[model samples]
Structure formats: C-alpha cells, structure tokens
Target: MPAVVVTNHGGDVPDFEGKITIYVIICVFIAAFGGLMFGYDIGISGGVTSMDDFLKKFFMNVYEKKKHVHENNYCKYNDALLQLFTSSLYIAALLASFVASRLCTKMGRKPTMQIASIFFMVGVGLQAGGINIVMIVCGRIMLGIGVGFANQAVPLFLSELAPAKMRGALNICFQLFITIGILAAGIINYFTSKVHPHGWRISLGLAIVPAVILLIGSFAICETPTSLIERKNLDEGKATLKKIRGTEDVIPEFESIVAASEMARQVKNPFSKLMKPSSRPPLIIAILLQVFQQFTGINAIMFYAPVLFQTVGFGSNASLLSTVITGLVNVFSTLVSIYTVDWAGRRILLLEACVQMFLTQTVVGLILLIDLKTTGSLNHVEAVIVVVLVCIFVMGFAWSWGPLGWLIPSETFPLETRTAGFAFAVSSNMLFTFIIAQAFLSMLCHMRAGIFFFFAAWILVMGLFTLFFVPETKGVPIDSMVEKVWKQHWFWKRYMVDADDEEIKEQVHPHVK
Candidate 1:
C-alpha cells in the first residue's frame, strides 16, 4: 500500500493510510462546470457572429419602417459590435475575478458558487431575448460575473479540499471541462446552425440550462471544511473533515487547517505579499505562465478561426465546419492530458507542448507569410498545411499547457495565499486575454501572418522558461511541495544538479509556515 503522511496545524507530519475519497472527485466535477461556462461563453459568441447577416436583415426591416435612421447605422452595429457581444462576458469575468478573491474568502465556496449560478441563469436568459446591444451587454456581464467567480473560486476550492496525491489531476479537471464545453458548443453550433433557422440565438440561450442544473447541484453539497475553520467553527469544521476524510482521524486535519489559516492571516495584503522578494519567484512563474498561456494563441484561434479560414480562401460555411474540427482536436487532446498529467508530470508536458507548438506555428506563419505571398489565392496543399499546423498546435496545447497552467498554480500556492495567488494569476491571464482579443482583429488586418510569428516567439520563450525554471510537480504533495520550492537556492550553487533529480523526501511535505 502507498504510504500516507498526515500533519496537523503547525505540527510535524504524521503517517496514515487510506484511499483517495469520492467527495473530492464529486467537488471537482461540480466546480469544473464553471469551466464549462467559461468554454461555452468563449465559443458561443462565434456562433452568434454567424447570425450577423440574419440580424442585419431582421433589424433592417425595423429600421426601414422608422424612416432610415442613418444610411450605415446598422453598419455601425456590425461584426465589431457583435464581437463585443461575446467579449463583454470575459470583461465581466475580469471584474468578477477581482471581487471573487475577496468575496469567496468571506462567503465560503458553496454559497458563492450557488450565487454565481443564479447570476449565470439570469444573464443567459436576458441575453437570448435582448433586442438591443445594451441588453446583450448586460446579459454578458451577468454570465461574466458567474464565470469570474468560478474561475478563481473553483480551482482554489478544489486544491484545498483534494488529497495531495490527486490535486493536480483534480485541478486539471477544470481545464478538461473547459475543453469539453468548447467541444459541446462547437458540435451544438454545427448541428443547430443547420437544423434551426435561428441557430445562433438558440446557441446563446443554451447556456441558461447548464446554469440552472449547476444551481440545483450546489444544494446537494457541503461547504469546504477550510471555510468552516476560517470562520472559527471548529466543531463543524472537524465534523466536515471527518465526513470527507472518513475513518481517518480528524484532529490532525483540523489542526492543519487552523494552522494554515492562522499563517495566511498574518500576510494581510495578499497582493503585496506576492511581490515581496521571498514570494517573487512563484509570483513571476504564475504571472508568466498566465501570459504564455494567452500568447500561445489558443483563444485567438478559438475566437477568430472562421475569419481566419475565410481570409485563407474558404467559404463561410467551410470556415465554421473547420472550426468544429479544431474544437474536436482540442477536446480529445485535453482528455489525453487528463489521463497523463499525474503520470507524466506537469513540467515535462509543458516543455513538450511548448516545443511542438513552436514548430507547428513557425510552419504556419511561414506558409501564410511566404507561400501565399502577393497572391489572393491559396493552393490546396497550403490550405492543408495551415489546417494541419493549427490542429497540431491545438493538440499540443490541449495535452499540456492548457491543463497544466491551471494545475501548477493550484499546487504551488500556500493555503493562506491560495485565493490571492490564483487571483493574481487569473487577473494576469485576463489582462493578456483582453489585450489579445481587443487587438487581434486589427492585427490580423494589418500584420496578418506576422501575428503567428509573434505568438511563435512567445512559445519559444515559454519553452525555454519551462525547461530551466519550472520544477517537476507530478505526484508531489502540495504542502511539502511548497516547502521544497521555497527551500531552493537561487544563488550560484557549487555544482549544477541534473534536471530530473528526485526531490529530497524531506522536502516533499510542508506545514503552515
């Protein structure tokens, strides 16, 4: 049997034996639905964009009866405005993530998720029937708020509640569900866009059903034990731990919770704390990982695949169909990551993904920049090359960076600062996402293939950074894993050690500092 080590608050670790619990998996699945929301929100807008012609036609009729408001009035309400229709959801998420770091801490995880679901349902409902852009933005914001809450809260909650052995796998489930959501949206859009005459509206409205289902699911769960301890409800906290831990002694677990909370309370300014010299390494890693994840060009592809295909000489329907294929590649690759993450480890997968992505994107950039030079036509071979590169890039991301980015931060963070740590990471992610989404359309217009080159360079940097700096985290227990990382000497060592060195056993477990 695998050895189990347990520790109480501010105490030396103790040993125990048990199997991983079902409750942890249950929580991961429920919370990961929030990722589904993220994916749905991200992809559903593309389908909505598909209906721009229909919308213009429908609104044109109304505008004609109103005596022609302006010659190009609806032109002002074209793709850019429709892009905002989807982009606003993420904008809302960016704001909500900041608020959530504070709110989730005070309100506790279960209640907060319930509240988010309510907002999600409300937002999706309003958005589907929204007559004006104003109403649409409002609905988008509602869903955004829920998404923001889930993004920060769910991963943080899952990390804290899960067993050390399974934390990485559990946390990656969030990303896995995101891929699943993207796939679902793509498939649904593909079928519905043909079957339903008003397909895009139906796609936008489908988000409401999932939100309602998640809301109902929340009632069957209990508050995280950590939150109970944070509130000084020791008896309830202990009982909750026992319920989850099952036959395992509760005192040590309860004590560990109290100790971590006490230690976290001392840090006061979580953001400021991250900037201190001692804390800077992890913060940089967290921030850079988020930056690279965005610049790896995943979202850019997802957001504008159809436009890209059209620009590369494909019809509108063909472009959408191609996007569905890309989404499938993404979903399957993510499932591969879910199966391999704990087995292959985070750092290895990250490095491998970055390298492969760099090569594929380089080919793609060259093909776009040189092969089609000064010509408006793309040859069949060149088109196939672009599709293959895009597929490979998506595969690399799905199996590595996509899931591991979310997993590593959850593992690296100390409990006291986990929420705040994730907040910074998530905020950094949003900042980059915002930058890319806002400017990518313009960049495609002006720079075109140059954008792929820019992202390829980012991937190259990400690959080198991961190779040198990112430590192997697979199978490492969270508390001990954190302690070990902090104990590393950044100053010149007498001799360099091998990259694959096994972590010192003593450094694998940590208590509340």
Candidate 2:
C-alpha cells in the first residue's frame, strides 16, 4: 500500500493518492481531446483551402468565370470569399462560447463537454461530405460552435479538477494538445494533399476520429466537485471529491468548496458584481491578456503559414512541408512552458516571450520589406532567414502567451464570477480570432511585409502590459486569488502580498491583520 500523503489546508488532509492522480490524469486527457479537435479544425481548413482539388471544386469556377474581366481582381475576390469561409467557424465559436457559459453552469462540465463533442461530430460529417459551398459553410458553423464550447469549458474543467500546484501544467496541457492537433492536421494534410481529388475530404474528415473519442471519454470522467457543490448537491460533491482526491479525508477541501460556492450564490447578480470597483482589475487582466494573445499575429501565422511560405518563394509542396515544421516547433516549444510555468512563474515568462516575439516579428518584417523593395523575390538565403525568424517567433509564443493566455483567466476570477468571467474572456479571444483570421489574408494582400510590422508593434505593447499589470500567479491558492491579488489597489503592490505569507495575508485581510 502507498503511504498516505497530506496537504496543509488549515488541517491535515490526505494528499492526492496514486489512484486518484491516475483518475484525474485520465479525466484531464479526455477533456483535452476537445482541444485536439479545436486545433484540428483550425489547422485542417488551412491545408484544405490550399488543396488544388478543393480549390477547383469550390473556387476555380469563380476564378474562371471572372478571369476574363481581370485576373487579379477575380483572384482577390475569391481569396476574400475563402477568408470568409475560414472565419465563419470563429464567428460561430464566439457565439457558442457565451452559450456554453450558461450551459456549463446549468448542466455541469461533463454534459457541456459532451454537447461540444456532438456538435463536432455533426460538423465534421458535413465538411467531409460537403459538395457545395453552402454545405461547407454550415459545417464550419457547427464546428465553430463546438470549438467555442470546448474552449471555454475545457480549461475551466481542468482548473477546477486539478490541484493548485499542478494546475498551471495541466492547463498548459490543454494548449499542448492543441499544438499536437495542429501537428497532426499538418501531417495529415501533407499526406492527403498528395492524393489529389479527395485528399481534402480525408483531411477534413480525420477530425471526426478525435471527436468520437472525446464523446466516448466524456462518459467516463466525473463531474467537477466545484460544479456539483455549486448546484447544491453537497453529498454528491463530497463523494466526487473523494474519488478525485482518492482519499476519504476530503472534508477540508469539501468545506472550502462549499464556502466558496455559498459566497458565489450570495452575489445575486454576478455580472453586475464583475463590473463593480472591487472586481474590475482581474476582469481587465483576463480580457486584455486574451486580446493581446490574438493581436500578436499567432493565428495569422497558424492559419496561413503555407500560403505565407509560398509567397516568400517556396513551392506548394515545400510550403506545406514548412507548415509541418511550424507545427513541430510549436509542439516542442510548449513543453518548455509546461516544465517552467510552475518553477519560473507566469509574469517573467510572458515578459521575456513578448520581447523575443517583438524582435522576431520585426526581423521578419524587415527582411520581407527589404526583399520587396530590392530584389522583388527572396534569394535562397533570405527565404531561410525568414523561415528561421518565423520559427523563433513561434517558439516565443508557444511557451508564454499561448498557454498563459488561457491559464491566467482560469485562475484570476473568483468562483462567484468564474463562469461568467471565463465566458467573457473566451468570447473576447474568439472575437479577436475572428477579426485576425478574417483580416490576415486581406492585410497580406495589401500590406505585404507591413503586416509583420503591425504584429511587432502589438507585441511590444503586450510586453509593456505584462511588465506593469500582469501578476505572477505561481503558487497562489485559487480560493484566495480574488481577495488577495485582484482587490489590491496598486499593480506593483499586488506582488508584495503572497497568499502563503501569513503576515502579508493578514495585511490583505484586515481582521487577520
């Protein structure tokens, strides 16, 4: 038998046992499949749109019919239409995320995740079989809705279920799966694109496999104890907590959860409370971090990497291959975040990543701009340089903003406003994702290298934002985050108070002080 472990939660409670750790890990993996599906849908479209057969089936006629009038105009118009097709999912996802907030609260986390899986299955079916633009559009919308629900609910589910010490790494696991999904889609696209006429269908349909896995896995995972308690099922909540913690001495944790839920219930209007003076700081932090994450040009690079590579002198096959490299770098680099997030802290990683990203984006823009101004085409060396710069930029993102952006909001809000706060934060992310996805190609068409410069400027702004405002949430207990961190009047002063420091804790809570 394994030795009983203990936690310091004001009393001696058994620490998570081996069996419970296994159960929690299994649940997290199942929930994270939602992220895998999210990445597959996002990455699949990029490759699918690049496929010759896909283009011929959907876009060739438009180009052919209008080619006589002006070839460039027709091509531009078709590109715009394609952009709209790609962005449709994001728009639907934004709307679905808000709905998921209510659904997750009402139905509980497990059921809400199952709902997303169902949407993903239907959406993947339509897209795979889609013969017309209308069918594809409808499919994208369904997938978008699924993405929204999964994005909002998965992180929240993982956070609630995970222990504070491992919470950052587990939440980052959500992003890790996303990168894996992207890499998988890229590999699938690379192979399928070689098959010609029906390859795009295979790429689009492959997403269904993960969606099916998620649907089945959803049945096995337990409901979050916090959600159960909030619904007033105290007995069931305690039972679930025992299962999750793998120990019968779950009284302390259960009582803590009950207290938090009761406090949340006291606030009749969570939304209005969110807008109050006391709640504004954390809410602002959540919203702005999400905004900066999107505005940093990560999605633009993700969605159109193949096309961007082709523009800089690579052939279609090579462009697709290069996209695989981007996906690989993304996956490997996120590992850095998973390992360091707990050790190095959030604020430092984010600040450093922003600086590196700023430099990389600037270098990419300068190289592209100089190429346009001088040779009008990149030499082999310059092309390599551009690719190298892009890889570095992606590395900076994978370890920092990419994971922290999701992790922070999940940690910031009090339980009272957590669901609503997450809804708003995720909706913000999706909304910007839509704007960036819709605008990327058009901006590239007109601005060329200037688009990279635009991204560089935003990255600089993000670095400053981090330096001044973003709090370091290394080992802070979730229960005390709102009272200790968010309610602090000064940004610099926020870090002065540590949740674990008894003296500092006393200062924050006057009665204790």
Top candidate on TM-score is 2
lDDT of 2 by residue, 163-257 (tens): 76677888898999999999999899899989968999999999998889989998999999999999999999989888877777777668778
Model 2: residue 440 alpha-carbon error in angstroms: 0.7
What TM-score does candidate 2 reach?
0.90
Global CA lDDT computed for model 1: 0.71
Q: Give candidate 2 regions above 4 Å deviation.
A: 1-20, 61-78, 373-376, 492-513
What is candidate 2's local distance difference test score? 0.82
What TM-score does structure 1 among the candidates reach? Answer: 0.86
TM-score of each: 0.86, 0.90
Q: After superposing candidate 1 on the true structure, give the runs of residues whose Cα lies further than 4 Å from its correct spot.
A: 1-18, 52-80, 195-197, 373-377, 489-513
Question: Which pairs, if any, clash in model 2?
Answer: 5-15
